[model samples]
Target: MSKYTSFPEPGDDHNPFQDPAVTQHSSNTEYATLDLYNPFDNKNGPPPPAYAATAPSAPQPVVPATTPPSRTTPTEPRNYGTSFTPQTAVNATTAELLRKQEELEKKARELERRERELDSHALGPGATRQNNWPPLPTFCPVGPCFYQDINMEISQSFQHTVSIMYYYWMFTACTLAFNLISCLSLFCVEPSGGVGLGLAILWVLLFTPCSFVCWYRPVYKAFRSDSSFNFFAFFFIFFVQVIFYVIMTIGIPGWGFSGWIVSLAALKTSVPVGVIMMLNAILFTAQAAMGVVLLKRVHSLYRQTGASFVKAQAEFATGVMSNQAVRQAAANATASAAQGAFTGAAR
Candidate 1:
């Protein structure tokens, strides 16, 4: 008589499928991962034939949730709500994927329920159901294994985009306020006072719009696309401006145009320069911190798309990925398939 027992005897680590009795047990698993792993194994036995139960020879039909009355589905708009598809692994389009995921989740839940029913009917919850599970060798990540998936890589990019939005908002506020106030001052002040009134007018009317279009737009696009080049360009322009402003603050009397009223006689030394110098120091520190943050973000994005920056110290990554990964050949292909979804490429 066949040893109906499915489990390997104790002290066996590698002989799960040796007993054919439990080999086919995972046929009912949600994603059909029964073949992936089997735990109960014994090396010393004749491989058992799978003990798959055969219904008394009748085939089962897959019944739709709601069968159509007669052949009227075509005429009456066969509204079975949403059509479901099995969630086998593959990259399907959005509509197909939503349907697929729903089916997989449904299957998983149903399998769990059936296991519960069998357990309750047979041994009950407190009683072990080790006999019920298929022989699995690997750790099974069944429920919510979605989080453990590499798919979360896409999810993380979304999170990064949110953070970039915050930065964009901050910069937007600074730019808008500075331009509005500075431009207004230019208009109100006399032409003879400070820099040329023509320059101020041009700065207000021209530079504000131009900066917004050229700099801010690209930065925003970089944030959305998670691209490396956009980030590098943004920082390069931003820090250049920061350095210029710092120089102007130190070189000019009041750290701003027309703010210095001190006479050369009163200011013999760079002693009055202390506060401005300190403020410049603080600005530099802030810029450095900002640069570090952008550096980290750009590094992460470059990992997504092969780009490099000075701060990205992962020599293995920046140096190698762009070269051996068939970088140029893959880029156009990836970019095209991704649609215009990627707003910009950075440095």
Candidate 2:
């Protein structure tokens, strides 16, 4: 008491330096306290406490456990936007592939059906569906006709000849029909109706079949076959028919009923008959022209075959020399001539 004054300081009651427990408590308080304003930190509030900074963060704001939308939903509308994800793209690609596969299957089935139909309808090898009636002739005449095996390789000139020949045949057939009708009309007007009718009937019965067999058929065969023999036979027969046509056109008065007879009957009886006859005359004239043209075409065909009078004579000689029947006939004729010559001398 003599050495030091007994005076109490302002913080003597809580002397933190003198008491360990006080010091420890003060440290704990300091650590727990937050600095609302700190010069060291640029943040709006004070920095985190040292312990909090050192410790692991309270498990980061637990992210919501979410599942992505399914792309495979059939009811979902297609998203055409550029924002589509990879999963959606994969689904769209798979769907498109399936659709295309279905389309391909349908097309394959259709093609298979068509192939079966074609196979069923197929007639024969090298034959088509168009091989029907009415004989659709090809534009190129030098080819196959109605018959499969029968084909002709003719020149353009020869084709023109064939066409003209067909026209001639048609004209001739028409002329024959016209002639028959005219004869019938003339017979109706004639005084001897029965006789005229009989003649007309006879002419129709005889000439119709005869002309077809002798002339038209031969010509048709010639064109179809391109046979030299058929051509020659047609020319000979047709030449005779043409002569008959001319004779019929002349009309022998009472015996034969013809276009000319009809015209004569028309002058004597009916104007209608005359008109019909005149029309017949026109047709006959046209037919004659056609015949002439056909004859020229026939001659052209003949020349193409290297036929001539000399060739004809050579053929005749060859045939006679080669044929036994012809040779026997010729020998008989020669013997008869000699016998007659000898008999005449003796008499």
**Would you list the C-alpha lDDT of every candidate in the order shown?**
0.46, 0.63
Tens-digit per-residue lDDT, 226-326, candidate 2: 55555676788888877766766666665454556546656677778777776876777666666766777776777676545565456557756899998
Task: Provide C-alpha RMSD values for all models, in order.
Answer: 38.4, 18.9
- Which candidate has the highest TM-score of all? 2
Q: Which ten residues in a row have the lowest lDDT in candidate 1?
A: 144-153
Off by over 4 Å in 2: 1-157, 220-226, 308-347
lDDT of residue 53 for candidate 2 = 64
